[model samples]
Target: MASRTAPFSPFEFLIAWRYLRARRAEGGVSVMTWISLIGITLGVAALIATLAVRAGFRAEFVDTILGSNAHVTVYSAPMEVVEGSGVYSSLMRDYQVRAERVAAIPGVTRAAPLIRGQVMATKDGRSNVAEVYGISAADLQTIPRVANPETALGSIEQFGEGIAIGSGLARELGVGLGDKLKLISPEGAKTAFGTSPRVSAYTVTYIFTAGRWDIDRTRIYMPFAEAQSYFNREAGADEIEVMVEDPEHLEPLAVPLMRAGGDGTLLWSWQDSSSSFLRALDIEDNVMFVILSILVLIAAMNITSGLIMLVKNKGRDIGILRTMGLTEGSVMRVFFLCGAFTGVIGTIAGVTLGCLFAIYIDQVMSFVNWLNGGGVWDPSIRGIYELPAKLQGADVAKAVILSLGLSFVVTIFPARRAARLNPVEALRYE
Candidate 1:
């Protein structure tokens, strides 16, 4: 009696699974499979981590620049005060009116007049050149660090003849709260000795940390009225600083708003101020992405080689299965599944490791610093000490898709080759 053999459900899948789990002695998956898997894993992880770091750096950089400066600055061409007091006064009045108009714009949040000038700060024989910002009490309150009462001097009202200096500047000058510091301005009183720089002693009302080394090292804040008196620019502010609801799109909003203020008004947005540097960053990021993607492509090529070797090694078994009525499509599916399985597993593992690395990059940097006896980022050399990393879901998805897609694409040649094997020739030598 001929016994009926029960069909193995999803025979191709079962065979493929068995092959994947086969031992080397049993003609199963070889070392090439492991090599391909590791290659894909490392490539995907590096890509994700790098992208995350770039995103984090961009975010932090934008925040730092915008926080330190205004979204838009409205000012006029530099004019010599000696030429015409009447013209200067009229221009100042127009600027004030324009500032008001700008504040009324749809997306405008705040607008205030500001005066910026260079001065030398001296205390205890130590002197450093610094930028002096003249701002009103209301305007000063809008600054992030300055807004904190603990970090700022008592009040702008109490800052008469007093100045708030950055913490770094204070440290360098060896000055503290209530201490007197001398401010020497190059544009000060003209004298018989060829316009001697104006020198004045100011009481240090408060010391503030701007959260950025560059700003903290070179900034001093003073009352607008006092600055006018000291700088002798009583005519008006040098420019108007504006804040907006959305700083990213500040240009479009700022341009039309400033134009509405009146003609002959010039405006500079934050983007315009930092365009070259920002463009460089974007170019570097794109170059890195392309470079990393090549690594994934190389890894995918490894997958292709691994599958080719796999098909060659299993040629006899494929022929036997074909003789047993397995269709050519089934053979193709079996090999395709094998390659895809490797990519899937590697992609998942890589994503997990990459996200963890991104999330904990700061701690990792700290550990490295500790290993190097600390001070990896010497304050004098590096403005920012912490390494930033931001993981975006879209970036991760892109990396995974790119890697898996490449892996799948490369598998086609080998999978199709396996399907086209001649059953008779394949089993002839066996």
Candidate 2:
């Protein structure tokens, strides 16, 4: 008699496709197949979306920090200077030459000297400690968002003895533009009755919001010349703040900065200043990745179970094919294709859903915030008021590959079991 089975060339794939599309009555896909597909889809989507959110948060945090501060700061080492009047002063003097040299460095974009000090700000009998930064108007523009004319009350040049305060700080002190406040500095003139803290009054010339609560609540900017006179440091600014073309590559500029600044000058990068915080963020990202990967692993297990059930269901059909001269390897390939198809389809669906979710995450967060009366992340409590999400192509690719790879690997054992089945045993009852 002629063989009943079709040739292996296209028959194996054809049979697999027919089996996948077949109805329940025709011994086609079972409920487990759908369940496994859903599992994989959810797993991949969750991983991609979660990773994108983490990356976004890290990027926003770094930008906020760098916006409020310079990429690098060069300052003279602490020195005890005895004035002509024999009064002792601890100051880092005369950084103009150092600033010029640092500005000439390859990656340096802008360099300006600044005087930084702490002072108690008093208004309406309410006192709050604040950091004072004194820089020229032109140099202040190079810092970051402060450069925008709309962000400040007016030009830095307009502020003679006046100061620019952050919006948060202004709100806290119950002060506004042109309002006068008292600033008490610890470095005071030597009096016969012990040293008295120097108290000076300054008009708030401008108001700025750096979008970071820390900066907005605790920082004030003044003119470099006025700050020098107020701090009694006629020598010059305390440090030179340097902006770079790329803040991420700050390490490469350190060597040249140090060389240019010469002896006693210390170069501090933004990374060095925020190392602990960045490390904490990195740890959080890693922990989240491991936790979310468990979902994908569970989905892979579902694929395994689904394939095993499929092999059992097709046993009689396999036995018939074997009797008709179908090779064991061909039988294995048929089942493998079935499982691989489910995996590939699920992975693609998941990738599409994940990318969509990441793209619209901001809007979702805003809606949630609105539902919660906008207190989800109060700017006063948290520096950032909104959740951030960035969709990276590499992250999506990794998630897709991982899910598909796991699915492919899990099919091997079940496929091999089907290939090793005994034709007579499978057909004995049928």
Candidate 3:
């Protein structure tokens, strides 16, 4: 026969489980047990759900930024110097060859010449400011969100014929496919009399949403040749926008990029340009985690209270068991099992619920939007069009560890008191 099991073997588990499941006319023990279970379940679920949403939102935010914009921008100064202005033009006049050289780098993916300008877009008496990007048919295909057939309403092949505006801009301007949208450029041909504004009409051949409110509300893409003529950049491009295989590890490529981009060319990465914005996002994530930790602490307190009441109600049972030669350590283990049982089961249930919620958040948000009569989330204010949630293993593990640790730590004090209770006094009081 096997050696006898330790004091906390099946005997302790059975006693703790019986106390947990025992029925009483007063309904105190069962009520406290249910409350503890529910509290722990809700706390863990809330923590997991909050973390999933933060992770998902961060991912979508970064994707929109990377998809709509270049990871790196190479600016080459023009040889022509302005007299008495003390300013040098940062235009890459030889952009064609510069783009070829940059694209050949090991990690470089795509390098395109771009001419960006701000203009006023008007249709049906409605007007909104728009940022125009002049890109080639081939280059436009590289933009993920715009190139995706699902998010884009029009064809990429037809992009060369007319201007492609964002979905938000089209909605705000009340313009549709094939409609003529007037573009008013402040920088026009300089004349002897004065500088006159250039107002031109272009058909809306394509419309797309970059999954970002600001991008969709303002960005427009024009044919490379058309933009060159319209912006008076026939000889050079404003900058060379470069894409790479790995945007997060762009530091290692700085020397290679600079060398290939030619002398006096300054390179700026997406991270460098958006340092403040990224820092704020980090702070927000930390604050959200800290706020949810309090909910878990409340659950810990609930466990402590329930176990203390349990010890009082089972005083007679403890006295009888102690008189029968059961050790104090065994009594402590029994009550400890009770608290740990509640935590383990509640955590498992909460993990399941939270994971399901994160996985189906899109469908859930759709129902919510429908119930609210179609305008629940405003992308312009929140940055993204829809709410997002992403489940991470690290977040789940952290929540589990936090819940179990709290359960075990809080049970110690209550268990100690039950063990120290005098058997004679407990029996006499009963």
Candidate 4:
């Protein structure tokens, strides 16, 4: 009959761990070992910190794109006939149908019509190029998530010559709300000898800050009727903007959205519009990950080399253990566990240090700014002044997996060498 006893505790594993630590100290670390350890710690910390920053940037910009731009944009290549007297009102029925169909599409939230044009904006002897957006304020509310609703133009019923300007544009023109700004249509313009372009002024009723330099520095928002009047087209808007339920599936949905646009219209996804920029960002992220991973890999090599040296020093002990009936597998397991133990310790320390630094990066930056004078952390100059750290569980998981996998790979060589030791040869020296 077996005697009742407590199960073998995992705490017993610490004995082997302590032995490894003692042996590491007994031999006295060379300068190279110290450098290697430092290199590993710094490398792991850098990878974690960088991944956090990139993820934060991606999240912030995705929100900006969805907030300021449409989930999808539809363009009419040439004029298409609709129901009303002209296309604007006559096409209302078809427009409604298309919008409903878009909404029914998987992952789509809402769809609305939008008209855009390039026009010259002038105020107080200051004139700049600007792009104008014409939208129905009521329908806009339905898809407010696509663009920051706080920045939407005032009531559509009040479309009468009212306009909204971006914060950057507002700064450039030195204008305020209720102040009037002129919009000169390109078609209406004429050279001194030719007919001058049609020029009109509208009151600035709203100001928006979207943090996108391109949009904030060059966009104007107005009522659809006002844009129609300025263009003298009296026709429908130029395109439609769609809001999606899941932005990640945008690439897959582009085909259907394009089909819905019909022959004359061109359907463009955000990915299509910004493919080059997004690709560049992808390349940059990959490069950074690869470069930093090399440092971690080098640190792993240090652990491997250190373990190899230990095995050589302990050959006599290994031989004795073998003669004492310890299986070769157990012998390998002991060293494998020891090396894994070191990796776990190093990993825990690295992660703790990295997260702490990331969480306080903004405060650190602010302190540095203060020390340097008083303006080193300005957003106007740096683009984003706030130190943002988003600790994603996925990133942490990846880092741990990578560190452990590397540690395991590096341990294999020393483990195999230790397993091959001959008792007679090892005992000869002793």
Q: What TM-score would every model get versus the actual structure?
A: 0.89, 0.88, 0.93, 0.79
Residue 119, model 1, lDDT = 90
Best by TM-score: 3
lDDT of 2: 0.81
Model 2, residue 30: C-alpha shift (Å): 3.3
Error of 3 at 160 (Å): 1.5
Better of 1 and 4 by lDDT: 1
Candidate 1 lDDT by residue in tens digits, 181-262 = 9999988887787767889998988777656677788998888888887887786778888888898886568567757557
Highest lDDT against the true fold, candidate: 3
Clashes of each: 0, 0, 0, 11
lDDT of 3 at 231: 82
Q: What is the C-alpha RMSD of each candidate to the true structure, in Å?
A: 4.0, 3.5, 2.4, 5.4
Regions of candidate 3 where Cα sits further than 4 Å from its true position: 1-7, 77-87, 367-374
lDDT score, residue 333, model 2? 81
At residue 187, candidate 2 shows an lDDT of: 79
Query: Which runs of model 4 end up more than 4 angstroms from their true locations?
Result: 1-15, 22-27, 30-37, 79-108, 142-161, 189-194, 251-263, 319-323, 357-361, 364-389, 427-430
State the lDDT of candidate 4 residue by residue for 317-378, as single tens digits.
78987776655556666677666766776777778877877788788777887899877645
Q: Which residue runs of candidate 2 sit more than 4 Å off their true CA positions?
A: 1-11, 22-29, 80-90, 149-161, 370-373, 378-382
- Candidate 2, clashing residue pairs? none
